[model samples]
Target: ADAQITSAKIISLDAGKITTGSLDAARISAGSLTADKLAANTITADSGVIADAAITSAKIASLDASKITAGILDAARIDVGSITVDKLHALAKNLVNNYSRTSDLTGWTATDGSIVTDATLSAPVHRVTTTTNRQILSDYFEVDPSKTYKVTLSIKCDSADGTRYFGLHAIDKDGTSISVIPFTVSSRTFGGASSNFYFWSKGGATGGWLNLEAYILGRYIDNQSDVPEGKVVTSHCRMPANCHRIRLRYLNYGTAGTARTSDHFSPTVTAVDSGAIRAENVIAGLLQSVTGNSWISLDNGQFSFGNGALAWNGSSLSAQGTFEAVSGTYLAKLDAGAVKLSNSGVELGYFSIQTAGPTGPWITAAAGASKINLAKLVGTGLYTAYQIDWGTTGGTSATHRFWGTVTLNENALYSGAIDCGAIAADGVVSCWRVEPHLDNNDRCGTTTKRWQAVHALEGYFNKLTIGSNTCWAAGSMSLTTASWASVSFGKTFPSAPRVFGQYTHDFTGDIGMLKIRNITTTGFQATIGGSGFSGIAANWFAILV
Candidate 1:
């Protein structure tokens, strides 16, 4: 009853006529309230004038953390690198080396192309402009089938065509290869590369080509600390159970059967949850199992393999093959029976090489059980140049030693005892002192074995070439029942030699006189006019004139 005026009488109420505290927000009409009509400082959050849903981020130009209340911020709203690797998944490591090559291709091979490099590049850029289909291969290394591997590479194509391929080959223990998975040129996802691009492996079947997208790992980035290059391509591979060794390969096909100019950069291979790889190290047990020419172990330490077997045991060394020492035309080797030295095809068993420490290897006469014995091998027969006389007078032709031109540089000394054997010297025999002269003693050298060791002395029928008409070459031959036969002059004469012919008969009738002709430096001709002269023998001598 105080006002009793309801209805249309209150249609024009002036703000000056009503008290400020009398009207509340709910009493006003809902559609009539607008942002521009609101008075500054008139509405407070505590006054319940503005609803929470009515204010949005679009409505606020500036915001402070103190102004934010009651809700958590989304992860997308957080800054980058705010987290660390302790917050990420582990068990992954880079398996391939030299992928980001600053210099050489240590673990990679330019199988079909040459290595290309640049100064400004952080990695190598192998260009494939040389071959129509260029290929690159990684080191053939051991891998475990339980692990999953990833191969990533970034490529820039200057000129492109045809198709590019990535392949994974599985190798057996014997080095046999198996194609586990392949991205061949016959089947590829992308067309001829004409521009620079970034590729990806965004969730696909195993061995299938990855889908291409403009965005990379960050496309679905959830963690602030997770960062990766956007352009590098990645492919997945699982080592087959049949595989023993793993090898990664890439093949680049060109455009229109012509090689394209493309640069491949930072090709990498990675493995997840891989424990360790079996590699060669200090152990020789496994290496010894390998047959063909490999480093092996000995009793003392280690050594490499050669053609022969060698062993060293502290102070002693054992060699199996021929212990040979050859210089100029002189050869000295240790045989099964004796130690021998040969000069100008004249072999003598009298010396051996002994290792005397600091003095190195020196030639010494074989002593102890290795007694010096002169022996020579002819075909399947062994000939002893010196032999002991069986208590006989005349020396047998079996023990008749043959002598040739021997140039003795110095005196030949004899200190050790020598058995009863002959030494035939045809040329100059120069010596200091030679004892055990069998020419005087019957128990020592036989009469046929020993010589009356002379000094500056000329004896016997040795071709000495005394002066005019002296031929220093002598040999004997017979032409008994034939027309003609040849005989050697023993030494090449300076010219044709003068001949002296003599005939002898062993009680039988004498044959025709022997004739000599066709004189050459190496040999001369001996002929006979008569036949059936078997009973006669001719003793001819040629003297150089």
Candidate 2:
């Protein structure tokens, strides 16, 4: 019994430490053992025990076909470089058919020209055998009129000495060329120097067909002014390049045209280099507008306005005004004439016609051919100043009266005749009076007064030595002098003169006192007594009152 007990104990101990070969499927109890009882990474697909709830994600080393389920992966889960170009091309749409011309010009039509496939060129070439314009047009392509596109092409000369004119034309649904932009290429070598030309096109067709045309013609003469009407030419002296690799790219579109509503035009060409010809057209339009009433300033020296109306050339400024029928009153006007104010000195800022006083009302020119009387008054107003008035009353009229005060500074000079009243007024109404004020020695600050009724007088004193208070006259008389041998005074005095007379050669026998009776303001008359006197001489002095 002891031997049996010991053996059973050893057997039970060995059973608890059983090796992998000691355990069999039958030894394991179903639903009794779990994955928690095994070490980490001990259960895997190779272990049949993992048939249900097979290894959790944490136990896997990496993912593979056996680890992942079918149709469970998506683009987001797929790694990069897994997709091919063939796959992408199958999903996208190509707007430009036959973009590379893999097949010979299958999607293009040539008018008056033929497509020439050249080994040297990357794409098919357009060959023109005539001087007339030729075109290679693409099939009508559907496009959104509200979008803009960039059209590009590479151009070079195909034949040496064979210059060509090349341009891009946009045709609308109505078959009318709406926009045309062209350039020239001038090169003598095959595959000569070429330029990449780019242009913008705002889609024009509205629910209609739109197409692009490439035009090729003989090289345009440089600076040629006699281009045929309705014909396209290049302002530059370059031959067109062998154009190929034409492409259209999506750009900002949807811009409207300047023409009719619902009518769209191609996008405005904005390339500064290619659009120079268009600039000439724009300048021409501006010049036309200048012919009307528009004013254009060019630089600082040149300016123009209206149609031959006003212009300032490099030298002078010119202007013209039209003469229209006069209907109402005008203060001042220039009719069919021009008033130029060009001065190198101090200029008048403005002129005013006002009343005599500084605070007086404004004065307007008379209506029609009416005249306003003018008068000059000196030292008349409160300020005792000189004034020029429009009316006879010196700016005192109830209507149409104006005056301006004249303040003469020191050393001021006026050299002109003052037409007082008509000739009937004796041409002398007042004389300018300059008086120094006793208050100050300054002549400019002195009070000035004009003396009225002052007349001018002139005379000659002949051989007379008169005193300071008297004027003397003397002359000779012949022996056969008449009864009235007059002694003449050359000029007049302001008032009548008091005459004192004596004869140097007096008559002795029939002596007579020298009578000086007819005394006038100008001169007094003197006579000798006898007519038989010869070689007689007389002298007299006349004192003027």
Candidate 3:
């Protein structure tokens, strides 16, 4: 049993003095007695120290394929929700070639890993070196008939032969070239260097490079007025509606013996749509006058004539008159006939009978013919009576009572009065006054008529001058006959004028305005008489001159 325990005949054996601290892991046999073995935790707790430091095959744990899976050993497994943003970046760069979304795009490029740039289609890159050689680019235009576009080409010549000429053309879809613009490359300077065309090119180490760009711009068709600034025009519509493609090209135009050489060149052509409509700019200079015989229509559905009309809507009863083009100074060709002025063949006021005068408005009448003519009173007087005669060539005095109608036409030209007081043939000699009233009484009225406030007739004269509130005269008077006994201011007197003092009346109803006549006076003195009336005291005054 001791030999078996010591394993002399066994395949391996381990012998040692069993000290509590000794560890001889190599000396132990591979298949030791199973019942004598102790648990690892129990050995470690009881001994408080490890026996052997060397690792050997006898102490290894068993490996099982069933315990292992992809989650435990897969190198690249990731939690779909918990994967970090850095992982996504690496995935994007390594998995997708067009990771920045730039693939097969003609006008775009991956400027950075994340940004795509709009590489605007420019003029073809020049690759030739020979002189007088021309290169044409392939067709890359996408014509859209739904829109209209403008083709603009901007070029500059840095240092060129002075005699060299250059030109540009816009090739339409129909194989037609339109000369949109033409400019000269005169000798100029750019970037502190001498050049043939300052605006054509910029000189650098590679040689002189020119920047030529083209874009689809817009313009107003109706604005046939002026050119606009900036690379694009916004205020005008393009012509030939719904036309789109715009092509640009450069040509050489120069005198013989001069080469048109361009070192480096770039041309940009943009495809743009029409933007918002803009108003055309007004020209800076003064506007020229435009005259045409065309008629303008008003929005209110009315057309105005070359001339205008003067119409009274009868809004008020106040008197007013209209004036047509004048024929003479104090005369007008009236519309009505001379008979239109008569009420009847019988007189109404003082005079009787009527006949047309030389310059008629109010006609004259012979006494026996009936109808009073008011124009016969030629002197400045209150009630000077003159006889109408059918018996002689001149009128003779006649006394008769009458009644008549008086028409006051505002359009009539009379300096002082429209006197209609001579109607003696009619039974009642009544004279009606219907002057214009601009106040509360807009209509004419007999009761609102104003009576003259001064009485002085010392004239058979052509001119008269009255004072502010006094009546003075300077005309010849026949002191013998009472036939010339008439007052200057009033149409009638309460009594006769005893002497010149002052005169007044209650002529305040519709009697706001006054009209007085100036006639020739033969150096005769006139007077105002109003001392007797009480109401006349407030507005009464006297002046000699």
Candidate 4:
């Protein structure tokens, strides 16, 4: 009906209800409808009143998200699983690479029997199934120092003991642990039936170990903590300060009693959580501890390792504690002024410098600071068989001074008169230096033995050659008549020997004389001085000056 009539005025409207298109949308004001104009609960939603696909996205421009003010949209109105990840715009993303089981986990480094295994775990996991201490360290990731970050690790351990756990640490550019950085355990959810929410943290002495330890505590059993097998633990950490980089450590330590397996799953490290990172291991703690004047300092502007134990710093370097090499087998310990070296915890020997001697410097070594039975050899005989025979007289065996008959090859100095048993000679007997001061006055030996040694006939009766001549020699030879006679000697000298001989006959008044003329190394020549004499003998002698 295009027109309606009012009963009172007989107009063209009957309360505007009988008219079609009487109140057009273009002519109607927005929000002009009043509930009083209609009966309460009059209009109902049905196929007759509303058509299908009537309420489209374009039609909902009146009730869009911009129009959602002063109240929250009921989540119940949205179907389950209708809101997807793509629907949420600019959500905080995980900073960790391969957080899901999307890759082989190349972002982690395995240490000590840790590996990437795809076994019974639902996804390929970073795992360790060793009897030794096993760990896997994640690769260093860049982080923001301003915004707070949260790291989540999904780990499964065969041991519920707290010893098997994971840790979070911040490192520098050189991969060294940074001190004075603090973090918090934001949240954690345990999976196993026997999982405990308790954790333990140890502020290490050097600020390098056990910074933040999130572990799986065992269920109580008889006042002792017992482990549950195949437990899964999830930990979320929020760090306040990360100057350079961050790494995660998942470890299985002290699992000796039983074999243990640890598995890691989908993890995340996002900067969604907000908080201020506080200080923990500050350098002031370390600087305050560097007390006393005996600090580690540079000496002589140079540093060098002296021997295998001590390090030379200018003049000296005193080591405070035991210094172990890269391999634990080699160790150097300092006790007093000596440095003891060892291999595999066995004290081998030590090197010490004798500082109290009159000499300048000496390197002294001792054997384990104890008297141990050891073997030594002298020549072809052992030291035991070559014991010195101390020839004692006034004292007992223990108190006797060494006057033994033993022969030693060492340089010795004696302070008493020597009573020789025998001075055996197997080679040439030659005397070099002989200083005879027999008298109380240190002048010389008495004239008797002094002259006797110089002109001894029987003691030293050998030919002495002085450059080109011999000392002295004498003998008797026979000479006859007017013939030239030769004086024969027992042996020849190294040089031409001097000969002086006078012929003396046994016959009375035999006037023949022998005169020596030429001398040679072999022999000497002599001729008769008297004429025509026979049957006579002469005595001859030879000497060299």
In order, the Cα lDDT scores of the candidates are 0.49, 0.38, 0.32, 0.46
Query: In terms of TM-score, how similar is model 3 to the real structure?
Result: 0.22
Give the best candidate by lDDT.
1
After superposition, the stretches of candidate 2 with alpha carbons farther than 4 Å from their true spots are 1-107, 110-125, 130-135, 148-431, 435-545
Question: Which portions of model 4 show Cα errors greater than 4 Å?
Answer: 1-93, 110-121, 160-162, 173-175, 180-242, 275-545
Off by over 4 Å in 1: 1-94, 111-122, 179-235, 257-259, 274-545
How well is each residue in 1-545 modelled by candidate 1, as lDDT tens digits?
Answer: 78789867777866787665666778899798788987898999888988889999798999787977799979998789987654532212234544345444556674444567644464456656644556677777676555544456655554424556554566667887654432111222223311122133222122322321111111122232222222234322233455677665565655556656555566655543222233342443534535655454534455544533664444566677677789988887776434677766665334334444654344333221222335688999976654432223232323333333323465443233322233334454443333223323343323444445433212222322323232445445667555567777666677887655544333332234457888777777776655565434555556554
In candidate 2 the C-alpha lDDT for residue 427 amounts to 36
- Candidate 4, residues 1-545: lDDT per residue as tens digits? 55563557565655656555465679778888888877776776652666777667775645556756687758888899998865642212355554344444556663334346445554555556667666666777777665444445555554544356555566656776664221122322223221122222211121211223232221111111112221222343223343467666666666675676656665565653222222452232211113332222222343323322444466766555465443567777766666676666656556566445664433332333222223367888744322222223222222112222434566333333323332333454332323232332322223432311321122111222223224444555555555666665666767776565544423333253346766776677676555565545544544443
Provide C-alpha RMSD values for all models, in order.
23.5, 22.9, 27.8, 23.0
- Comparison by lDDT, 1 against 4, better one: 1
| Model 2 C-alpha lDDT per residue in residues 123-217, reported as the tens digit of each score | 55444344332334444443333222223233333222222322343335555434222333222112323333322232333233122322222
Error of 1 at 258 (Å): 3.2
What's model 2's TM-score? 0.21
State the lDDT of candidate 3 residue by residue for 1-545, as single tens digits: 55456446468544554546765788678887475577655655247466565556587688687857665645456455775555543223221122123222123222211222323333333322223433322233444544434343333333344222222223456655432221121211112211121113222222333333222323232222222232321222232223333322233333134444432233333335444433353333322224322222323222222222322223422212332234333223222232222223432222213343544344455343543423444476534243343343343544333223444484432354222322124344222334333433432444453444233322222233342222322222211111222324332223323222221334443322221222223121332222121212212112233
Q: Give the TM-score of candidate 4.
A: 0.24
Error of 2 at 310 (Å): 27
Better of 2 and 4 by TM-score: 4
